[model samples]
Target: MERLSLNQITTDNWNMREAVEGCARASIPWIALWRHKVQQAGLAESKRYVRDAGLRVSSLCRGGMFPAATKSERQARIDDNRRAVEEAAELGTDVLVLVCGPAPDRNIDDARKMVEEGIEQLVPYAVSCGVRLGIEPLHPMYAAERSVINTLSQASDIAERYAANQVGVVVDVFHVWWDPDLYRQIARANGRILGFHVSDWIVPTPDLLMGRGMMGDGVIDIRRIRKAVDSAGYTGPIEVEIFNRSIWDAPGDEVLALMKERYTQHV
Candidate 1:
């Protein structure tokens, strides 16, 4: 049987409880929880609802954003990630995804260094909590705004620098589809592949940051990437993580239903 999961931000307006119930009703198998919504919906109760609904948690939404201007700020980011790891453990989630932080002042190299240092600092703590950290490579367009880890090679290098099996990368196809190095890097990441997130890229992407089409609605060759990951031995959930306001504004259940259908037919 195939497994399914969702990123909480896809249903931006839905509270965690609402999202869980909606997915459960749609018979989707899992969810990737966001920090704010976890707190808003109360972690304990959220876990209960998910378990009660017999839903699996593929991974937790995040624990990165490691770059900062000062020592205090950087330390604060590490502390926050520690908390995120603990939260993932509490929820019985196997992976905690990391959106490796962006530059504080547009210095990409500096941000990358900070991401390395921060992950090194947090790994021991995360290990203690029994939570695996999955670094995510955002699109190059996000190099300045969201993450410094923008390539599979870069992310794999960092993961190898720390723990081979304990730390890995979450490959979101929408972010890495244009990379000429994706196939080779995915091969390199063989055993270290942590999670796989899916969504399509619209040609005239309305919003550079948020416009994402459904699996079969745009130009992404999702099955090719899926085949690559599967060949590389990644038997993880293909998590749907679209961040479109137009989709969010619709009935949450409708979106989830479509997500399940597409996961079966297209993705």
Candidate 2:
């Protein structure tokens, strides 16, 4: 059986800590944490709590936002990612997920080039820090402002371009559910898939950015995707990464309860 992990419910609210603790209480062994929250809680304290609670840090929530017009801006992101690599190593997570940034000038091709260059620049540093970089291909809707690497093939291509010192891709069903080449890309990803994210797509999608549904609450064939990913030799945890305001507004414990129930029964 694949284990479940709750990501960063601790910072969602003052009450969120209870929800996260409840998850630990439930014996869910893994969690992926956000950087800002970890900082706020104090890294040492956070790590200590997680370890004491008996949980494994799956992967850190971020690392790559590398497309910027100015050299200074780009370098700043590079520096940040380098630090992120070190942080992931300290957290003892298996990977650091990268959201390859978009072009400020709307040049998609240029943004892609920047992503490639950024990863190339950071590879050696990541290797030295004993951390792997997991490139997450965001949905095309986010292609303008958030991420430029919008396909698994693109992420895999970049991974192959760099020599094998732990560069891989994160496959999020919410992002790639619309892709025509998902299966082929999964095969291409092979063992390079270091992370897997799950969330459902709402019909009429009230908010393009938020409003993600829980498992089986929306239209995505998540189990099919899971099977494909498993076929590709990725037996890692299926991370639930929903950023829905409705859920966030609910009591954190209630939300966590619903999430765990649905994840167990449906996913």
- lDDT of every model, 2 decimals: 0.87, 0.82
Error of 1 at 166 (Å): 1.2
List, residue by residue over 1-267, the lDDT tens digit for candidate 2. Answer: 246777674226633245347667666677888888777777777777777777788889789889898999999999999988887888888599999988889688988998999999999999888888999999999988889899998899899876544798999998998999999999888888898888799887988877688888888888888888889888877777888877777876676677778887667
* lDDT at residue 193 of model 2 (Cα atoms): 87
TM-score of each: 0.97, 0.94
133-172: candidate 1 lDDT, tens digit per residue: 9999999898887898889989999999767667998889
Steric clash pairs (candidate 1): none
Off by over 4 Å in 1: none
> What overall lDDT, based on C-alpha atoms, would model 2 receive against the true structure?
0.82
